[model samples]
Target chain A: MQNETADFEITLRPNTGWMQLDLKEIWSYRDLLFLLVWRDFVAKYKQTVLGPLWFIVQPLMMSVVFTVIFGNVAKLSTDGLPKMLFYLCGQLGWTYFAQNFNSNSATLVNNAGLFSKVYFPRLVVPLSSLISNLFTFCIQAATFLAFFAYYKYFLHTEGLRMDWRAVFLPLLVLQSAALSLGLGLLMSALTAKYRDLVHLSPLLIQLWMYATPVIIPLSEFPEKWRWVVALNPMTSIVESFRLMLLGAGTVEPLYLGLSVIFTLVVLVIGVLLFGKVEKTFVDTV
Target chain B: MSRPAIEVRNISKSYDLGSIGATSLKDELERLWKKVRGREVSARKGQFKALDDISFDVQPGQIVGIIGRNGAGKSTLLKILSHITEPTSGEIVLRGRVSSLLEVGMGFHPDLTGRENIFLNGAILGMKKAEIREKLDEIIAFAEVEKFIDTPVKRYSSGMYVRLAFAVAAHMEPEILILDEVLAVGDARFQEKCLKKIRAVAGGGRTVLMVSHNMSAVRSLCDHACVLHQGRLIQTGDPEECTETYLGIYHPTTESGVVDFKKPENETAWMKRARLYCDGQLGTQLEMGKPLSVEIDFESETEMEPGIGIVINGPEGAKILHASTRNAPSPSFRQPVKGGTIRCDFGEIPFTAGRYTLSFWFGGLSYDTHAEDPCFSFEVIERDLWGCARPYQAAHSILWWPAKFELQG
Candidate 1:
């Protein structure tokens, strides 16, 4: 049949432009993004002994462990704040980023079967994980607020106060999400080809948490090493989160600016790399 | 004239066969070392051209069949068309909302209920939430899983699971559909239903591209077909001719009436050789109503009594006859073990004049092993069994049956 080819809806070629992000296509698949998010939320807790309760229990347990090891045993500085509140607040931000990052990093490898057989926006997977992990973050944040309330009202612990900057909590969450997703996308793309990174990722994330001020506040680090920690995009987000909610840590404006810039750069690079990999990862993966 | 629904222009895909998934640091170091020493390194050496310079056009509402033997690049082409993988060279233009069913249940979670899976799978297949909701009841009814809609899919039988998955895929209303051997699953009746559903989809003026090894399905369902062979498009034309070409690729010329298979090194049981005889003479052509027999040689490692089977399939790969030693009323052979030859004699071959392939199966009571290929091929020549010189036409049936007609007067 002779017909005009200009009206073709899709043209698959050997080389697409490097900057072709296809954001409209991703937007068109918004319904799939929503369903994938819903699936993650519903399926994650299936057959669990405590169900979504594990969401709260996980961070609480991690906070207690951090309180015992870093706060009580090691007597690490908590920026003049109570150990439970300090670690819980830190856990609140760190858990969200780490959970999203871990899941997103495994997006390609874990869903290789699905990716091989279907065509949707590959970003939909990590983006849905970002949304799904936010649900967990909300529950953990509520748990942190309960502890913050107890220390502030009942215990009336010294130096514990919510400031006007607490409004920046949503911004901090967004920054943490961006950093996680960016790094996760980068890692997932590399791991699809390398596979060695799959084994190295968890260890890297663990070491990365130590580099950030998750267990101990940035104030406790040596002055010379402060710049190294500042280079980590997560450092300012975690510090600013504790500073806003607990009023115990110092937030440097320059480092906060640097964190934002770093996150944007990484996010752009991650999205681009992930886009490049998604097209051909079915063969390598 | 209407526009072509799909135009695949000189599409080719290649893979580094040696380096796929071999990305560990140690292997990289070894490869580097080999390269440094001027030794031939295989890591980047074996570039396999899976689909080489393949091109075709499909018009709207055309149910096109992609027929090929395994490793003939059928899957590579489908993957490229469906966007699961990218072609290394060339391009394709598609003029519709393309949906590919490379697998039936690509994203189904075992813990999710059938109803939930319907939504998830529908979304993965590019359907909007409203679309799935609109067809929810119809999907459930088609799958026949209404009673188990709310139950976890892992709890349902495999048949029900396949039914549900196919029902969800069948309900999708994409303008262009790419289907792999998805119809090869399910029972005969369900497969027939799926074929009918595909026909209905095509009847809606949508384009369908299907890759299937089932020659009968290809011939019956596809109006046009393309034959792929070793990463190349060898033939493209009418379905009947293309299917014949595809089948010919498998058994180009097996007129010797004898086949010898290499003995498997460590297999417990294996078929060794087979020979066909027409009227007690070694021949590849069997006349209708003439006596025919097949002699099979087999070997077993242990002292276990194993049964052997022979299957004759028509030119379109549809099974015509299956004769198994285990199904015989009396024990045909009482051999205990080792190696031997067993000859099966057919009283009178009743097949219509056509080419047929023969497949063999060897199995014991506990384990079964089948020969990977259809070991032999033979032709049945047309003959006038009655006193008249009139021959039976294949349009009537695949077999010739004798009948006596008498007037009641």
Candidate 2:
């Protein structure tokens, strides 16, 4: 059979010639996206003992572990910043990135029932998942600020301070969201056809954290080797986030610009691949 | 002629059945390699076509009923029109916002309260927040779950679940609404209410495309109907006429009271042939107050102790009589009863005069092995009226009893 070529307001064909983002279509379904995010946030904490408080407890515990292992045992320098405040700040952005990656990568498979029964922009699933994680990130960030205030004022930590670049925290969060969502979309589209990709994702995200400047400061790496690790787009985001929030790391414009460019490219490729896969994923999945 | 609300042109969907089985990485890589080399790709290995060159137009404000036997591309057509799945080769031009209820209660989380689920489900169905908020009270009243609206849906009864789910779907406002067998939910009274709701929705100058097995509902509700047979469009026109053609296609005739089950539809039961006769004569019409016999010819591989049954339904699909080996005589085949004909005879056929449908069934360990609906239909004639002062018509009562009247003087 040959593909159909027809003209109408909404023409459904086998495959379109080129990739189209249809941002307007996604915008029109904004209410649906909000509801989806609301369902995720509400349902995630529904029957739990701690409820949404677990959102705070999780990153706090992880930050404590990072302080013990990387600060006490490895003796990794937090660039002369307080160990507790520095680890909590670093955990803030890294946890959101990891959570978004984990959930958004499974969006298609998890929503197979909804996707097969309805007709909305398929992008809404992953987009809502990223937004839902932002809720948890906000709570975690508040807890981080609470610690930063206690250590800086009560404990009089001289090295720990906020700079004018702290205003750039929103930009850093957006960067983290874009990077995770881009890679998440790409993996989600592939995992629909290859079940093995689903099994490998958790380990990939773990190794990715170690490769980024999550637990260790970017200055800890040798000068030559630092550039190699800086190739990871997340490296700049993490470094810039710490530099802005705690005034400890360098804010290199070249590396930050590279990360932004890399994020945009991945976002474009991810959107195109995801759009193509969604048209027929129901059949294969 | 008004502009068509939905135009489906040369639509066809073919599935690569080969991929469903190749769950391993190596097999997928091999398939990819073959595609790169421009090979025949396993030469139609397990390939199947779900829909073939199906084209149709539905006018605005028209309620169209899609009818077909099972596996006849009815659901496939709905899915394509809903944009859930893309057609292999076709284009569908839908001129308005389309909401397809291929399933009701699609994303209702059990952990969510009934009130929250209503908003979530409405949003998933493409309703704006303000729209859902506006219809919230009416939806709650219709579902009759107002008391438990604040409680989690998981704690509700199954009947309540279906009611709430269907109520949300019924309240949706879309330019074109597509429903598939959603009317089969809820109780009989609720089903009637849903049908009325659907009729009201279509009356408001919106296009509706519904697929249902309820012939009576389709006949009463749809302005136009289409029949699909084995992945192809067989007929499309007036609702009553199209429905009659669909029923006729399934109601095959028997020769000398015997139907040869050589067709694929008949093989579903592992049955070779069947015969129905009355008083030892091969006849298509039977008289009331007479002996009747039903014979089933089946091929069995095991000891063959499966239950066999026959259901007699009226023209409107109401079951008049259901007789099974377990229900009545408790007949059991002896050890190792291999392939052969089993006959069950009734001393008096207690049915009134009219056309009745016969459906056969065989039950297996966990599920029904085979079932044929409207497999064979025969007319019942009142040969003798029993010299009654008043005669009863078949439409008046389904049963014929031997009633005797005597004066006490």
Candidate 3:
């Protein structure tokens, strides 16, 4: 048996300092993070007929709806890209962001029962949600890639050359995950004491979707309004995603760099607030 | 020797009595907007102190039991020590990995299989995956749920679920273990099994802190005990002595012989007040051979037939005597509106010397209209029983009935 005494010393205080990450303590409990992520991934599809396939089905079905409403009916410009590929590409990023944001925002309230009875890094709750949702996003992204290949090969669609800048796709995904996670943490912290955010966030996320270039390409925007739209942190990521995969949408490096900075700032604020609130969330929650 | 395994210094916890958190988004936003506009936000009301400057220490390789009535800050103290919640002010130092079991099945997901939940619950308690893996078989065997380990826990019976949850908690090999009333669950045999595990764990030189209402269990298991009354540490010493003191304080009878109901029974009828008298004078303590009278004051919103019963329980929780309206010739209510004082008079009290609590019931035959527990507690002191030379004792005795001895030709 390992002597636990040598492992760590614990001291509890009423208030956590303004910035106390306790990164080492969180690092040691990484196994717990893994379990939390696994429970979420498995329990989500346990009794469903489609099981984990719901991951692919959700994005696929939404893509069809977007293709009809935005592509055909509304005649939204896809930057000369095929309708299926264009909408699917946009839906993939939005799905990951929406899912991560929604679940992570609910971390504290949803797990109140577990939180009150045990002690672990409170950050693990939202972090695990981010990781678990990433798995679902990857599965859905695979389906998008399959559709992209079909359009490139059999149809040989025009203006559909894959750009080397596609390598930045990982960076784009990371930015979205970080931004969603940060915002979610902030919301969760506030929601612990004020539950109004729980009912209001889903509607807010829907409204935010139109602000980002999820359905319409950035190229379709008028020159004067472009700057205003670029202010949304997700806009640059979505535009860059399309530019890399379809070689059509604009990719301004400055805008993308600004989004990364925004993400980091939000993340810091979120973590600080979460750490402070988690110390006493059980009592209020 | 080494320092104590745990040290707590002047720990206190207080909660806001207001709407604790925002009930809805609208309320929260309004509060925020009011704050942003620099308006006076007078929503928050009062503060309730749950724990008040509580300090204690537990030495290495010793088991300490915390005994108290409900709402005595036992849970708050454990929550602070376990890091589940923070105290309002104070400090706690733990020497090693501390595992707290405030409840069974802290993270048992009904959708997950028993095997999966074991790992999940273990991790939730800060156990590493490798540690849980090593004790998997032992946990399963201890829970007696091996046959259903692969099945979803939702399919298992509530007992099975508790057993599995308890098994995982019990398997944790922490240097310091804190438990709170989780042993109250499960059957008698399982309870015995859990007690054995707790004893063996303590015997293995681990520091243990336990809070339970089971006085006998504490007496048999703990090396030392602490008694808490209204958030303050009133006593700490031998387990037996601590438990005795806790019971004494918890069942206190008012000096005025009036005990109010802790909670209303229902919309129909409830106990308002209760009092005791010895030989027609208001008093709490009764002489063993003197006349005793109990007065129960009650009220009823709607008129209904109600039966009143007075039950006496001894210090050890055994029923010593019972007097009910049911035994009377006209037990049912004589009128539609039945609300007043019902008195029970005893010519010669038969109880031996001991602390006893009075319980009452006011309801129909099938259901209790209203019931009060520990409504009034009084001490019975021994007195001479009409010139009997035999010595009288209270221990190991319930009642002393009058008997005569004679020599026959």
Measured with C-alpha atoms, the lDDT of residue A157 in candidate 2 is: 82
> Which lDDT tens digits does candidate 3 get at residues B1-409?
8788899999998988976654666776788999999998876778888899989899988999998888999999999999999999999999887899999998888999999999999998989999999999999999999899999999999899999999999999898999999987789899999999999998988899999887778988999999988898988989989988987876766767777775463457877788788767887778887888888787777776667888888876667778887776755565655578778786777888877888888775445778877767878888777667663677546788777889999
In candidate 2, which residue ranges exceed 4 Å CA deviation?
A1-9, B21-24, B30-46, B261-273, B287-291, B296-342, B347-375, B380-409
> What are the candidates' individual DockQ scores?
0.58, 0.48, 0.57
**Which model is ahead, 2 or 3, in terms of lDDT?**
3
Ranked candidates (lDDT, high to low) = 1, 3, 2
- From the highest DockQ down, the ranking of the candidates is 1, 3, 2
Tens-digit lDDT track of model 1 for B223-273 = 999999999999999999998888787754567788888866667788887
Best lDDT among the predictions, by candidate number: 1
The CAPRI-style docking tier of model 2 reads acceptable
lDDT of 3 by residue, A32-63 (tens): 99998999888988988989888888778888
Estimate the TM-score of every prediction: 0.87, 0.88, 0.87
- What number of clashing residue pairs does each candidate have, in the order they appear? 0, 0, 2
Better of 1 and 2 by DockQ: 1
lDDT of 1 by residue, A30-99 (tens): 9999999999878988888888888988788988998899888999888888988888998887889988
CA RMSD, predictions in order: 4.9, 5.2, 5.6
**DockQ category of candidate 1:** medium
